[model samples]
Target: MISPDAFHAACLGLGAGLALIVAIGAQNAFVLRQGIRGEHIGPIVAVCAISDAILIAAGVLGTGALLTAAPAAVVGLRYVGAAFLITYGVMAARRILTPKALESADPESSGSSRSGRAATLATVLALTWLNPHVYLDTVLLLGSLANTQGPGLQWWFGAGAMLGSIAWFSSLGFGARLLRGFFARPASWRILDGGIAVTMVGLGVGLALGT
Candidate 1:
């Protein structure tokens, strides 16, 4: 029952959402790790997808332009996000130095660690919300793009963008288990941790430098 123009706008939104989201970054890495561990996958994926949906809606409502006007707010968020990324990167590096298997490191799997469901969820929330780049992407970039579709069809574009988030996070959080066999070895965990550390630190530095 959808009109051709609406369909086209939806397609554009979907493509843009995917292009912005489906990249190597801290959020994706965390989702992949959680998926592999088979711990809190549902809650984690739901949080990410829902968060994106809300942000996209905000963007489509023209909040992105409002945010763009707030240069000081953006700068503050950028520094906070950089600090968070750096801190997370340091944690990843510590995991590598500890010489424990990734599976064993997870309290959810071993039940001996201090991190509980609440703690894990907190971490997920912090990772998603603390990252200022997320706002820039979902709010400013996607919002501006959606507005360009004209007022009547912008909501369709936002809906399509939300669909993209749902599809992507679902795939990432659920589909990551397919690689469990490859990550069975401790060395794989170490390598993954190293990559994660590098990525986080690199991104943190990039944000700090504003490059």
Candidate 2:
């Protein structure tokens, strides 16, 4: 029979990963926007999956525990992350409200660029790195949680969590791509931008409120 502990770890890891990822936030929303626009898929997925795997591995290996011991450090990160997310959200909202005319579209930020592979990588790095909370949640919190599951099953647990990350992100990419064809209208951009803005602002507020 499969070890009960391993099974439990797998379930917990999967659940935790999915629970955290499913919520629409800056990263997911931005990915959706790009996927919808038929932008670079490989680099987007790479950014998401690689970041997740690295974080999950760190979590499982119990490397992020250092931060957990220091309450002040995590709190500091939370505030900084919230501010950045709010700024990002507001900018996205502005883009929606004042989308440039098709004839005079301005250059996109490196993250939103339509260039080749280099721009694609740049986008992923910027999006993932801008938010400090990635470390708090994925590294410290999840790592601490995994450490409690016992050493024997930590890898399995981490693997399940990784799967969850892959599933959620891939879905976000492909699903967004599918919708892109039908919802490529100008009005659709507004709707998506509005939704992203709301999600980002809400998350930022939640982070700031700490409850």
Candidate with the greatest lDDT versus the true structure: 1
- Clashes per candidate, residues 3 or more apart or on different chains: 0, 0
Across 80-181, the per-residue lDDT of candidate 2 in tens digits comes to: 767867876797788776857111111232234446667656756755765556777888777777777776877878887888998888888767756754
lDDT by residue (1-211, candidate 1, tens digit) is 9898999999999999999999998899888877777777888899999999999999998899888789899888889989988999999988887865467434256452336556767878888888888999999999999999965899889999999999999999999888787877788888989998999999998889986
lDDT of 2 at 78: 71
C-alpha positional error of residue 202 in candidate 2 after TM-score superposition, expressed in Å: 2.8
Model 1 clashing residue pairs (backbone): none
Candidate that would win on TM-score: 1
Stretches > 4 Å off in candidate 1: 104-115
Per-candidate TM-score against the hidden true structure: 0.93, 0.79
**Model 2 misses residue 182 by how many Å?**
3.2
Q: Worst 10-residue stretch by lDDT in candidate 1?
A: 105-114
